[model samples]
Target: MCTYLKNMANYKHSHLKNKSFEEIQMLFNNTLKWIESFVPMDTELVKGSEKVAKGCSKRATYKLEQEDAKRQRIEEENESVE
Candidate 1:
């Protein structure tokens, strides 16, 4: 009788473990769908942010180049005076 009960318990545990994989998958899909409903994947937001980042990078590059050019001009003028 004890052996039978142990076998039954083992069977139940195995069945539960099998069901858990499917349950976890269903939970993940449901969660993703719920989140998507609220957030609704915006391509424009990504593109806009990328454009803003590129603009900022270009502006920084231009500022650095201008500063370098100014410094080179000053050094050249000082060299000529010397």
Candidate 2:
């Protein structure tokens, strides 16, 4: 179970790495809302599902932070060349 969640987080981070922060937040919020829509009122299957979702969200944010630093460095180099 732990390994599965870690792989999921890694996949999500790879997929979301290129997205802007706003887009990432929007996707994360939508995912949570979708999960919430399946709450116990209909079925108990969604219990504790937020853990994986939050894990994915954190990974996505980390990926974007890493990419932001690289992007800024490239932009700085370009500006210095001008």
Candidate 3:
């Protein structure tokens, strides 16, 4: 199917080289209709996709503070050496 679309696109580009933008858009939309004929329409909204934990924000802030403290310590040590 992907190969077919690629070949069709090449064919369209070769044949419609002189066509206007509107004509090209219409041809592209018509080509997409073939995909719709093969694939079923997904109308339902996806539910319950909770990716983050409850304390994720707190943990992230703590991690950022730890990294900042480490960076500050490194800078302080470098300044003392100089």
The most accurate candidate by lDDT is 2
Which candidate has the highest TM-score of all? 1
TM-score of each: 0.48, 0.45, 0.36
Query: For each candidate, what is the lDDT?
Result: 0.65, 0.67, 0.66
Pairs in steric clash, model 1: none
Where does model 2 exceed 4 Å of error? 1-45
Full-model lDDT, candidate 3: 0.66
Q: What range of 10 consecutive residues in model 3 has the weakest lDDT sum?
A: 42-51
**Which residue pairs of candidate 2 clash?**
none
Q: How far does residue 69 in candidate 1 sit from its true spot (Å)?
A: 0.5
Tell me which of candidates 1 and 2 scores higher on lDDT: 2
**Deviation (Å) of 46 in candidate 3:** 14
lDDT of 2 by residue, 20-58 (tens): 778666666666576566657335455457668889999
| Error in Å for residue 2 of model 3 | 32
Model 3: per-residue Cα lDDT over 2-76, one tens digit each: 344457655544566676778767767778886565633343222222225436777899999999999999999
Any idea how many clashes model 3 has?
0
